[model samples]
Target: MLLHYLKSSLDDIDHLIDLTKKDIEDIKEANHELVFERTKIKNDLVKAFENKKSLLDNELIKMVSNNKGMDLESILNEEQKTLLNEMKIKLTELKSVNKQYAKFVVIVSEFYNTLLDKIFPRELEGYKKANRTPATLLKVRA
Candidate 1:
């Protein structure tokens, strides 16, 4: 049960990391609709990952209870330990990639906000940011 959960949890995280990389590319290409479309998938993956992690944790706790005094690392066999180490490394990579993606998103958002501000020229009232109205498209017949 322990090894099964361990492997499954690892797989879940790997999928999330893959999705994150793909999302970064989608953003770079300004395929925002695709990015938004993937959000539900990403969220589902995250929920599944969390569930696997919770199951893994329960299994680990049960092992500790059965053996008494032994910590998680001590109880894990070589294979389990290896899988845990791989998860740690992958998690680090995930954090790095997520941070990079976050920065890119902030830059894109700021660019759009600045452009809107220039176009709309918001009032300088006592608000932190300006309120924006919807932009309209003009269609003319030839």
Candidate 2:
């Protein structure tokens, strides 16, 4: 039962990581649809894992603590250990990919801001009225 829950959680993380990778690709391609899809996937992933922390912290902890001084590795089966390790690796990859995506987003935002500034001119001097001299003929008529 514990292994089952752990595996399920790992699968969720894998799916999230896959979606994040697709998000990066979609960003590069400027695909709005795929980006929206990735957002939905991210929300679903968050909902799925929202309530599982207690199970991991309480139930899994109790189970793993039963083997005298033995750690989780000594208690878990070979397949379970392998799955846990794989989850860790996938998590690390996800972190790195997220960082790259964030950097790309920041660069794009800065480029957009610079473009807008050049076109719209943010400084007050750009909007100031031109100075002009009054005609002298109007004074003679008065």
Candidate 3:
């Protein structure tokens, strides 16, 4: 069961990496359909990965409770240890990819906001602005 959980988690990370890269490509190409489709799959994989990680953690805790003296390294076999290492590496890669995706999203948001501001200037709208209060509780006479 331990090995199964580790392998399944690793597999999820692999699929996530692929899906993330594909989404980046789709975003670059302006393929909305593929991007949305892959986003759903990626979200499902993320949930599965979280579930497998939780299962693995529970099993490890059980093992520790059962065997008071032994540590995790001693409890896991060589294969499980290798899979855990691989999982760590793949998770770092996934983090990097996710960072890229986040940066892209920010850029796109800024571009749209700038475009809207140019096309329809807020000053010309002649509408009363809301939320005029300061963010903090301090009162200023200026």
Candidate 4:
């Protein structure tokens, strides 16, 4: 029973990691819709994982503690330990990917702001006429 729960939790983490990778791809493509979809999927997965964690902590952990006369570490067999370790590694990778995605977003935002500033100077008002000649017009010969 405890092993089953641990395996399920590991599977959930693997799925989450997969979704995060997809999210990174969406970010690279600048696909806002896909990113939003990925975010929703991730949020739902998180809620499911929370429920699973509650069950593990409240039921599986207690059962293992009572039967094995030891904590979770002592109860887990070699395979379960390996799965747990793999889950930890995947989680670390996910963290790194998320950090990279955040940095990409910030860089994109800065670029957009810079472009906006160049397009609409702060000194120019909506009613004010620009004194400078247009670049496109200057290129045309009379």
* Model 2 lowest lDDT segment of ten: 129-138
Give the least accurate 10-residue stretch of model 4, judged by summed lDDT.
129-138
Total clashing pairs in model 3: 0
Single out the weakest 10-residue window by summed lDDT for candidate 3: 129-138
Per-prediction TM-score to the true structure, in the order listed: 0.87, 0.71, 0.82, 0.67
Predicted model with the maximum TM-score? 1
Residue pairs in collision within model 2: none
lDDT of each: 0.83, 0.72, 0.84, 0.74
Candidate 3 residue-wise lDDT, 1-142, digit = tens: 9888998898899999988888888878877689888877888899999999999999989988888999988988899889989999999999999999888778777988777655544443257643333334344578
lDDT of 4: 0.74
lDDT of 2 at 45: 88
Which sections of candidate 1 miss by over 4 Å? 130-142
After aligning candidate 3 to the native by TM-score, how far in Å is the CA of 6 from where it should be? 0.7
What TM-score should be assigned to candidate 1?
Answer: 0.87
lDDT of 4 by residue, 1-142 (tens): 6567667877777788787778778778888688787787888887887787787677655757577767777776788778767767877887887788788779878988777656553445588845443444236576
TM-score winner, 1 or 3: 1
Off by over 4 Å in 4: 67-71, 116-142
Model 1 scores worst on lDDT over the 10 consecutive residues at 132-141
